[model samples]
Structure formats: structure tokens, C-alpha cells
Target: MTSQARRKKVAWGITGAGHYLTESFDLFVQFKDTFGVEVSITTFVSRAAEEVARVYGLFHYLQTISPGDYMEEVILESAQGWSYPKTGRFSRGNYDALFISPTTSNTVAKIAYGIADSLITNAVAHAIKGGIPVFLVPVDIEGRIESPVPYFINRDICVGCERCQEACPHDAINEQIDYLKCTGCGLCKDICDYNAIQGGQVMLVVRDIDKQNVKRLRKMERITVLDDPSQLERALRNVLTEEAG
Candidate 1:
């Protein structure tokens, strides 16, 4: 491994929203494989992100994907005797940028309103204060987006089996699913051997405040709002290519 001086550092914060979680994970692998030698990337997961990943059966996968680091609202101050010292990388100029992909409306609103209560929020706050670049992909920017998720279950095929319930880390299902808690990770669908979980879609309604926050996000010089997951790859590729050039 090269020394810190030689590699560009990047911090990636994953939120609770599952709109593009799988797609974002694929992109992470692509980024690492393509730029492993040139960049040092650290991943931070929110508490909600951990729950959603478990629901998607990605709990183990997340750990194996990278050298892992996570932050929750409860554990604010760490050994550094400061809350969110990880963002210190930005202030110290150790990191080139921060990327928050698939940012939930909650996260986007908090960042736009200067709410730095959560780990991810605090990191973004510190990063922007430090003049570091922040690239974010908001899930609710389109106002109404078609999210392909497991929206239904074929009860006849379920057979009263509790495997799907057991597989759900968020306790979002019993005989029926609890929509409020479900992050649409599809882990229940993945674990059901009887094919009871049918594939479906849901139309997410974006809030007016979220739209306003997007507007606020647009005005920030340090923040770049990516239209979607694919655009993130192109954006990073372009920047890295320019740096190389």
C-alpha cells in the first residue's frame, strides 16, 4: 500500500434510503477496482443504513466490500475527544472530496437547513466548512420517481414460513410487511425460497420541502447534486481523469 501522501483520500457516506443502494454498491466496487492504487476510500454507514442493509441481506456484504467504518448518532464523540473527527480529514486537507450517494430526503433537508445532528450530517457540515468538495445524489430530486422494489407478496406461495421474517433485520414484516419500516432492500424477497415475494414497484412522492432543499443544494459551490447513480460514475471518472491529466 502506498503512503497517505501519495494517494488521494475520499470519504463515502451511505444513508438509509434504498432507492439506489444496490446500484451504488456496484459503483463502489467499480471505483475500487479501477482506482485502488490511486485513491484511499473510507465508507461510513448510518444506523438506518445498517438496518436497511440487513433487510437487503447485505449486512455481511458491507463489511467484506471494504475496510469498514460506521457512525451512529449515539456514539458522537470518539477517541479524538471530538464529535465527527473523521471529517477532520477534510479540514486537514487529507481528503480530496466527500461523496454521499443516494442521499435520503431527510439527509438532504438536514444538510440544507444546517442540521448536523447525525454522523453523516455532521461530516457534510465539516466538509463544507473546510471548503472541500461534496458530491451528492439525492433520491427525491425528481419529485415523483418510479422506484422498482418488492412492493407485494404472493401469500399462497408463502406457506406461513417465518424465514422471510427472520431474514428481515428491521422487523418490518410479520405475516404482512410494515411499509414504514421497510427500506425496500429486497432481502426478504432474496431469502424466500418459495418465490412468495413478488417483484413490484412503488411511486415515491417527494415533499415540497425536499424540492426546496434541492434548490438550496444547487446554490452551494462546494456541493454538486448528481442526477442519478450512473451520473456519479461519470462525474468521478471525469474528475479523476482531469486530475491525472
Candidate 2:
């Protein structure tokens, strides 16, 4: 009821591993106060990351002001060497937009290749279908490249544990890097939890905010959750009711 949770709210969609969620939450804390601006984030996580998020304290903070709870949230379903989540809840038309942060190389690949077998990917495909704006921020992965500049791999850090490839939900992680399929979702790093993986150049950015920049928004003193179905429904019904009256 205080200013910490007041003002206009924007619907946010965060999907990936637990680490990205934590870093993103920390980033939001930096923008708690601003002029005529309030930002809020609500997210859904992979089943495995959910436990990590709980162990990492990310879960407690996220629940205090759930954008709409699991009823509106979802579990992602991955594939092959990785696990996936049930993703349709976030993809539904009610929410304003979607963002998959700390997007891993594999998640990026899924998006880049139009793989929609699971929830997040399916939703990503669907968001595009509706001409909705979708944002991605994959955690940096350390590896080789040949984008006319020969992106080299340290290999020294490569323990050959193969866990990253094992964690990919989209079957996109390959021994040899392929930029075309990598969408930068950051799942490998989040699942590692042991700091075993480093991301390649992933995708991330700020959108939906007004003239002001919102690289951070958790500490906002005035954030209003606008996606509440009741409120939206009421507002729409009022428009019709007023005309009838």
C-alpha cells in the first residue's frame, strides 16, 4: 500500500534459469525511483530453475507481488539434452509483452530457428504471430566464432563436463557454435548454479517504458500492476456500459 508499490505497472515476462531472474531483479532495484515512471516484472521459470530460484531468494521477492500468479504464469518445457517448460500462460493475449532474459545459447537458437515445441518457444513464435514485440537477453556464453573476425574459444575453461549442452531444452547446443540458432536465453548458466558456464553475446534490452530508461525497476516506490484481469475487464466493460447508459 505504500509508494514502493505504486504507479502505473507494465506487464513483464521473464523466462529462463534462476540466475538471470536474480540478476534481472537486482537490475530492477536500481530504478526504484524515477520521474513519472514505474516498472514491474513478473516471470515464469523452468521447473529445475524454480528450485534454484527458491534456494537463491529470488522466489520470495517475486511472490510478494505476483503479476497474476501461476494462473497467469507457466512452466517451460525444454527438449533433447535439456529440459523444457510449459509456456502458454505467458503467451496468452492478456499480458502486454514478453521477455526471456539470460537467454542461453540454446534458447536463442530455438527462437532464431522458429522451434516452438515447448511453452516459451511456442509463445515466442505466437507473440511474433500476433505482431507483438518480444525481447531477449541471453547470458554471455564463452566460445569460438567466425563472424569474419574468428571468435575464438578459451577452451582452457572448458572442463568438457558437457553440462551446458546437457541442460539445453531445445537440442540446440552443439560442440561447434552456430550463431544462427542461438537466441541467447541463458538457461545453461542459470542451471549450472556452480558458475561453470559463460555465455556468448546474448540478446537483452529495455522496452515498454516511456521516454525514461528502465535498465532497473524493482525498487520503484510507485508501481501499479496493470494486467489484473479484474481491472482490465472492468475498464473494458465500463467503456461498453457507458455507451449503453
Candidate 3:
């Protein structure tokens, strides 16, 4: 009888940025079955990321991906206290590597400056200290980017019926979309008798400081900066290949 190879475990961190959230999640789902080798992903979501995931309708999706354990499979910053004890897994040699995809400019700055305040940031620090390779895809690496917005309302189409507002579970709708409160459940859009609510992509110009931060991250030790989220699969494959060699 032949024995099956042990699955490679990876730590994936998520931030508040919505640019590549969907794409990153899609890639995450494929990690378990698509990779040549068996791969197990443990997702670590920042507090703001939890909100963004909810707004994007991906919070539940993440839960579905890894339902085995709470902190073991899906670690949320909200549940972790000031110490972020779970990050110790990296120093204990638990994860093969760390991947922070669709990272926000704020997170990039924090990591570049060696700030370990948040759960994801602390994980990066431990991953580096433990000699584990870290890969990141900064959303603002380029000068400009077309990012997806979770929801929007066309006032012209809206009749001020307040039906959408009443239907909103998160109370994200009033006169306009209060992004901070919205979880992108799309319930308001679905309940609206008129077609006022909608969602689409938008173009954003990356600040010069953010671009510089990405440059700084590239020069950091044990960190690989990817051009875009699409390159994640290839970069990870190369890392695993090098490890096997």
C-alpha cells in the first residue's frame, strides 16, 4: 500500500482592500484541489478585512471554504486579543509560507515600516522571524487601477420609497450608501421595487507614496512582491518547486 503525501499548509492573510478580494478568494478556493500537491490554506483576516469581506458577501464564503476549525482554519482579528497568539504558529514552523494577496496600501505601509500592531501584520513579522517566505500582492503597486465597488444607488432611479432602507439588514442605506456600515449583502438591491441599487467597477489613481511603499517592500528580506493577484498561482508554484528541489 502507498502512503499519501502530507498536505502543504499555507497561511493566507487578507486586508480591507476590495480591489482583488474576489479574485483572491477564488484563488484561495482553488488551492485545495487545483495545486499539483495537496494544499491546505489557513486564512487570517484583519478586522477591517472582516468588514470588507462582509460587504463583499465573502465572509460566509470564507467560512464555507475551511469549516474544519475556528482559529485553525479561519482566524479573525476580532477574536484575537492584543497578543495575537495564533501567529506563533509561524515561529513554531507550522506554515510552509505566508501569502498576503490583495493587500491594502495601509497594510503595505505598515509591513514596510515593520509595524506589528494587527493580527495580519504580526503574522508577517513572525513569518519572517521563523524564516518562512512571504508573498504579497499590493493593490496599489501600479499608478492606476480599476477596482470593484460593492454597491451603489442611482438616485434618479430611486423614488425615495425607503423600502430598500427598511430591507437593509445592516442599516447601510438611508439617503445614500454608508460604506462603513454596509456589508454588501445586496438585500436592499434585491428588495427594491425599482432598479436604483447597482454595483460596478471604478478607476482609482494610486498615490505616489503607495507606489514607493511597494518599492520598499520589494527590498525587504524574505518577501516576494508580486505584480498582481493573477501572478499568485505562478509565484506560489515556483516557491513550492524550489522547496522540493
Candidate 4:
């Protein structure tokens, strides 16, 4: 049997779409239990994802379970404040596969257009450039999906400290909140000591191009597209089996 230290590694990137965020973590837990010491799993998350996970009440699951699996921190900024060296793990052969789950529409658009502004986007871009295989699970693949929307529960409790605004990665919070830019990560609710924030659900309407772009992504070389969250375990099994062969 191969030693745990010598096990192949997988880089899992989480984005800020609440549609399947909870399902994604459940899939990861199963992947870890099945793979055992055969694979090392590290998770990288976007700023928006951090917020969304907190909003959806799944961040605690990630935080508590990740350390045991060698999961890395939730990366909010670029590695060097400009470029993402975390992708170096893939470039240097440290990571055998790249998996991005519950991919936000914003991330899909960025990847489709070859944009790499955020950590998740940059990691995917670099992995593709390096000829590494990428597994993507886009939330808005076909039609409308339910997503979370977070807001202040009581204006009276808000102290005008701007902590929630600062915590928001998408700049979605201002004197007036911008729902379109919000990822609904719900970090603000945790940050607000006064208990002034709350999370709600809304249906996110996907545009024609949103669906078309994801379809186009499926045609890309070395990119395995997954529409169902349950397929994640199957996909990881395939990757590990291929490597073992």
C-alpha cells in the first residue's frame, strides 16, 4: 500500500453559489471516506464562497472536517496579491486533479471568457493552461436555481460599523444592498454581534448565455463537466482509478 505522504493530491475549489453548496460538502465527506489514504484533498475557496457557505450554515462543516483531510485555508485573495501561486500546486505536479464545485454563474462566466481575477478562477485557469484535468460542477447549468440572499435583520441593531460591508468580498453591501452582486455567504450574519443579519432564499434566473457557456465548457479538453452533485464521488473515483492504473 502507498504511504499517505506519497498519496496523490486533489485540489477542490469552492465558489459562492448557494444552490448546491451543502450538497458539495456532503459529497466531499463521502469522497474522503471512500478514498481513505489513497488521496490527499485540499480545498480552496473564493471570498464569495466563504460568505455564501456561512450564509447557508455550511462553513462550520467545512472548517471542522477539512483539517483532518489536509484541506487548506479558504483562500480569499490571490497568492501574491496579484497572481495565484496556489495553482503552482497543480503546475508542479503537487495536485493530480482540480475540482471546482457549486460553481457560481460569475465564476462560469469568468472561466468561459478566460478571466482569472479571483483565487478559484485563477486556479482553474492555471490548471487548464498546464494541461491538468479539471472537474467542474456549475449550479446554473440549465435553468433557474434557488440561491440564498442575506440581509440585515434589524436596522436598529446595525451600529454603522461597516464590518459587514467590509466582510463582503463582492462589494454587494452599501447604503443599499445589491442583490445581484451578493453571493449570500452569510458571513455578515456571523460578524454582526448584534444579531442583525439573516439569510433568505431566492430563485436565480439563468440567462441563455449562462447555459450556453457551461455547455461550451463541456467541450473543452480535459474538462469533465458534472451536472448532478451525486456524480462527484463517481468522478473522483474515476480520476483515482485512472491514476492507479
Candidate 5:
């Protein structure tokens, strides 16, 4: 009888940024499907990421993509407490590598400054302390990017009836959409009688401060900074190969 090769375990983290959320998830699915025999993945999703994923209509896909075959588990921040006890696994060397893709600027700054309040940031901290290689694909790494706007209100089409506001469960709809409060539930859009609610893509210019944060993260030890999410496959392949060797 022939024995199967050991699968490399990876910890994948997702933040709230919508810039490359879909792309990252697609790549993740591809990696697992293509390299299931050689690598296994466990996904860690932040609380904000859950909301953003719903907004983009990818939340269900994220949950089902890893059915305990190629992917091991999907850990959610909402399911964890303030201390995030699951993150202790990283410190225990439970994973071979940690990869965070479509990472938001907020997350990048927090990690660069050593803040570990959130689940994703806490995982990165513990992973680094445990000597696990950390790879991040920051959404705001480039000077400019075309990002998807999950929801928006058109003033010209809105009748000020406030129906959309009343239908919003998250209180995300006021004078405008407060993205932080929104979960992309589409309640406001559904209740809007004026057809003012809309969604599309928009061009965003990266801030100087965010670029500097990426620079700082790049200088951090044991960390690999990637400007594009597409580069993640190559990076992960290289790491797994090196580890196997």
C-alpha cells in the first residue's frame, strides 16, 4: 500500500474590504480545488468581513466553498468572544502559513502598529510570534483602484419618503449610506419606492497614509506584502514547496 503525502495546513484570513474580496475568494476556491491533495486551508473571517461579504452577495459562497474536504474549517469572528481563543492555535504552530487577502487599510494599519484587537489582526500577531510566515494582499497598496460600491442612494430619484430608512435594520441608511453600519442586506433597496438605491463600481485613490502603512508592513519580519491578490497563488505555492522540501 502507498501512503498519501502530508497536506500543508494554511490559515486564510479575510477582512472587510470589498476591493478584492471576490477575487480573493475565487482564488481561494481555485487553490483548494487544484491543490487539495497537497494543501489544506482553514478560513478565518472578521466580523466586518462577514458584513462586507453579505453586501457583495458572496457570504453564502464563502461558507460552502470549504466543505471539510479540501478546506478544514471556517472560523467567524462573530462566533468568537473578545479574547478570540481560536487565535491561540497560531501561537501553537497549528498552521504552516497565514495568508490575508483583500486586507483593508484599517486592518493593515492595526497590524503595522501591533494592534491585536480584531480577530484577523490577533491571528497575525500570534502567527508572527509563533514564527509562521504571514502573507498579506493589501487592497490599498496601489495609488489608485477601481472598487465596487455595494450600495448608494441617488438624490435625484429619492422622494424623501424615508421608507428605505425604515426598512434598514442596521440603521445604515440616513442622509447617506454609512458603510460601517451596513451589512449589504439590501433591505433599503427593496423598500425604496423611488428606485433611488443603486450599486456599481467606483474609482478610489489610495491615501498617502495607507501607502505608508503598507510600506511599514513590508518592512516587518516574516511578513510578505503583495500588491495584487493574483500574486497570492504563486506565493502560497512557493511557500508550500519550500516547506515540503
Candidate 6:
């Protein structure tokens, strides 16, 4: 095999994964074949995450690697340190970066605050030890840091079911909700019918994919806020593209 064609990978680790399962799934399909570098995505679903994935058709799009076949093969079958999904071997010798897209505000604060309750958070901490690059897409409407687009909005009437309270992954919702702390992805507001929920977008931060290099990635931002298989391809391609010139 030609050295250029030989595969070198940048492993991606996705968590809070339920929220963006469909997004993640589509991302793999769009780039996996074109890039030739394996686009492995791990869905770290607990019982709750699984339910969301099923309801939202996330599992359907992620069938191959979602631990069940109801979903499709666009998603790869991978696992975390504990049984989860991964793109390639992430051991000491396998990866170039660690990225978590759609990073929940809970996840962002936890990592920034030193909380490692789940697989993704734990991995982020681990990445630092090896000088690994870590990118993040923390979804929080908290304080209007800045936004690429307005958040999802609800135009219907209000039922006040408080059903949204049950769906919150971070217990951030309450009768008197704090918009600042909210990522505004609208998971809760979307499920409601009375239009009780409001608008705002989750923050998008690319934790590990270096921004200077992101230009080479074809359509990276749309898939998952944090991960982009094309980003890895660009990095790899640049190696020879630079050499060729």
C-alpha cells in the first residue's frame, strides 16, 4: 500500500451523545467513505440516553455501532474504556486527538471544574496527560457568550406540563429557569406541546480540533459541534499536500 493511502487516524470520542446521535450518525455517513480514515463514533448511552436515541431516530442512524442493529451501519461499532464506541485504537499509540462534540454544559463545567462522572469526561482528563488535543462543543445558552445562529424557538401556546423537567440531563430546568445556564438545544422545549419552553442555542466549542487547522476540514461543523472526521482527513492530507508542493 502506498504510504499516502495507508491509514493514519484521529480517534473521536463522543459523549452527551444522546442529544446529537442523529447528527453524529449523519456525520459518519457523509465522510467515512470519502476520507478512508475510519470514522468511529461511540455512543455512551445509559438507559436514558438509549431511550432518547430511539425516540429521536438516533439509534436508527447509528445501528452498526450503537450496540443494537435497529440503527444503521453508518455508525461504527465501538466502545469506550468500558463498553462504548470508538473510531480506532485509543491506547497510548493509536490516536492524535480527543474531541467531544455537543458537549453538554454539564459536561463542560464538569471538565473545567474537575468533575469526571462519565466516560467522555474521564477521557478528556486522560487526554491532557499525554499532551493529546481535546476539543469541546459545550452546549449552553448561559450568559450569551456568543452564537453562530439563534437558538431553536417555540411558537405554540403554553400547557405548563413540566414534562421538560423530566427530560433535563442536568437538572438545570426549574419553574424559574435560568436562561444563562441553559445550553438551549431545546430538547426539553421541543418535546413539550404547550410552548412552555423558550429559545437559545447551545454553545459550540471545538475542544481539540485546532482552529488554525480546521480550514482543511470539509464540512466539519455541521456534523457534531465537537467532532469532524474530515478534520482528521485534512490534517492527514496536508501532510502529503505539503510534501507534494
- For 24-62, candidate 4 gives per-residue lDDT tens digits of 989887777777567767788787777777655576666
Per-prediction CA RMSD (Å): 5.0, 13.8, 2.5, 6.1, 3.7, 10.0
lDDT of each: 0.73, 0.42, 0.84, 0.75, 0.86, 0.45
Tens digit of per-residue lDDT, candidate 1, span 22-83:
78878877787788666657776777776665455454544444554332112212222336
Best by TM-score: 3
Candidate 1 wrong stretches, greater than 4 Å: 1-5, 68-82, 150-194, 242-245
In order of appearance, the predictions have TM-scores of 0.77, 0.42, 0.90, 0.73, 0.82, 0.46
**lDDT of model 3, residue 193:** 84
Q: Which consecutive 10 residues in model 6 have the weakest lDDT in total?
A: 68-77
Candidate 5 — which residues are off by over 4 angstroms?
A: 1-3, 68-71, 158-196
What TM-score does candidate 4 get on C-alpha atoms? 0.73
RMSD from true fold, candidate 3: 2.5
lDDT of 2 by residue, 32-117 (tens): 22311343434545444444454343555555434344333333332222433233333454344455554544454555555765
What are the per-residue Cα lDDT tens digits for candidate 3 across 1-245? 11454556778899999999999998877764566245667889999899888888888877655655533388889998999999999898787889998899999999999999999889999999998889999999877799998888898898899998888888888799887788788888898888889899899999999999999999999999988878998866655545431
Per-residue lDDT for 194-236 in model 5, tens only?
A: 7799998899999999999999999998899987877898987
Ranking by TM-score: 3, 5, 1, 4, 6, 2
Model 3 shows how many backbone clashes? 1
Instruction: List candidate 6 segments past 4 Å from native.
Output: 1-5, 17-22, 37-48, 64-91, 141-245
* Cα displacement (Å) at residue 144, model 5: 2.0
Clashing pairs in 5: none
What overall lDDT, based on C-alpha atoms, would model 1 receive against the true structure? 0.73
TM-score of model number 3: 0.90
Backbone clashes, each candidate: 0, 45, 1, 4, 0, 26
